[model samples]
Target: MGTRGQSSAMGREARDPRLDAVIQTLQEIGNLMGRQAQERAANIAQATEAATTAAVNGNQANQGQAQLKPPKFDGKGDPEAAPRWVEELEKAFEVLGCTEAEKVTLAVYLLQDNANDWWKATRGRVFPEGTAQTWAVFSENFYGKFFSESAKERKLAEFMRLHQGQMTVDQYEAEFARLSKFAPRMIDHPEDKA
Candidate 1:
């Protein structure tokens, strides 16, 4: 009777094949789930890093644009003032890294009094509905209204007649710089400009 009881205890302690299979399967599932969770965490971290980079870049661009302070134009000064204002505004645009479309928009915003009125009248002619707006188009129109052909001819003549005689070196250089804009073709090369 003691031997029978021992045998019964041994049978009770024996492992089942089906139960062992089930345990192995559960461990495999847990390992697979762990790998999947790690991958998901890595993907989320990458997306978060990308978003942070884009936000920082956007903030930097906004800060640069904010620092720009273009001068205004009222179409009431010397005809040369028109070209000078355009030059100043272009420098501001370069510093701000503005797009061509942005250049036209910002340039238009700086127009005041007669200049604004001129734009209002000329806008339709230059930028008909459905036409793409560009800095070149805006510049052509603005120059047409403010800087006349006659004024440009006068500037070109002044540049052609420029001489260093009698004037100080600095004065001659200043006058040359002032008149050079009218004849860009003549000074297209560095040596020619010099």
Candidate 2:
């Protein structure tokens, strides 16, 4: 009976040792898997953060690059006129691709037409900062370059002729009436106000 009891105890010990080994192995595997999962999560988080930063930076750059000048029309007689005309004009001539100078120039001309030379009286109101010259202002307003040089010269000569009090009122009126349809409308050329 003593021998049989000893044999049973031995058998139990042998089985238990195998079970302990299996549990230990499984625990080790679980720990390793947990570490791997943590590493994977960290990597994914880092990638996502980088992508978000890049997207935000790209959007910021685009906003800066897309800067365009605003269109201008003279305030004419409006007291609370906008100050964006010259600002927009500068941007139009900027090397940026998003600016349009011609429309802004025409808008400025229209404003001058409305003001009927009153704009010059309020030069501070119309041209806040820059003391822009007439031809330069017109040239920069939209054309971004010089006007048709010959046509400009001819027009200027005619303007001088008309303004020097050489032409009769009727002749000047008829000639200007013809010019009104096609000539670049001026802001403060005494010819118009006369």
Candidate 3:
């Protein structure tokens, strides 16, 4: 009876080693899967942080550029409108931080009534479209047609005669800057410009 019992116990010990190996393998697999899941979660978190930082930086840069309100156009370009429109439009561009190309296109759209028709039919060329060419052509056309040589001469004379008057230093400087465009030739030296 003792020999039979001993043999049965040895058989049971042999089966237990195989069951222990299987349990150990399952635990190792579970630990590997847990580590992979943790790594994936960390990656997702890092990506989300980077995206948020980029969006915030973009908003800040845009704010630094231009947060100005949109402008309404009264139309009626060139000649009669040249004086006021030049000042007003340039100011609007500064406020809005528009590109030179945008200034040209916006100038066209701003024209009202007869001006738009005249420009589209006769003055505005279509062959050289896009930013650089359009800006150059439009500037040449606008200054030549709208602002006549005689008118520019008169503005130059006015610029020569201009003084500070009763205005503040800031106001005087602004007026000088505005008038300077008419007599660009006078500004030959850096000291003269200053």
Query: What's the residue-level lDDT of 89 in candidate 3?
Result: 65
Tens-digit lDDT string for candidate 3 (44-126): 45544554565567776454333232233344443435655656667656654456666776677777666577577754354
What lDDT is reached at residue 149 by model 3? 88
TM-score of 3: 0.44
Candidate 2 — worst ten consecutive residues by lDDT sum? 139-148
Per-residue alpha-carbon lDDT of candidate 1 for residues 25-80, written as tens digits (9 for 90 to 100):
99999999899777755764554455456556767645544334557899997999
Error at 61, model 1, angstroms: 21
**Rank list by lDDT:** 1, 3, 2
Error of 2 at 133 (Å): 73
lDDT of each: 0.82, 0.50, 0.66
Inter-residue clash pairs, candidate 1 = none
For every model shown, what is its TM-score relative to the native structure? 0.61, 0.24, 0.44
The candidate with the higher lDDT, 1 or 2, is 1
Output the number of the TM-score-best candidate: 1
Candidate 1 deviant stretches above 4 angstroms: 1-67, 189-194
Full ranking by TM-score: 1, 3, 2
C-alpha displacement of 166 in model 1, angstroms? 2.4
- How would you encode candidate 2's per-residue C-alpha lDDT over 52-163 as one tens digit per residue? 5655677764454334323445434322133235445455444322223333343445454434354455546535675533534443433322223454556555654555
Output the worst ten-in-a-row residue range by lDDT, candidate 3: 64-73
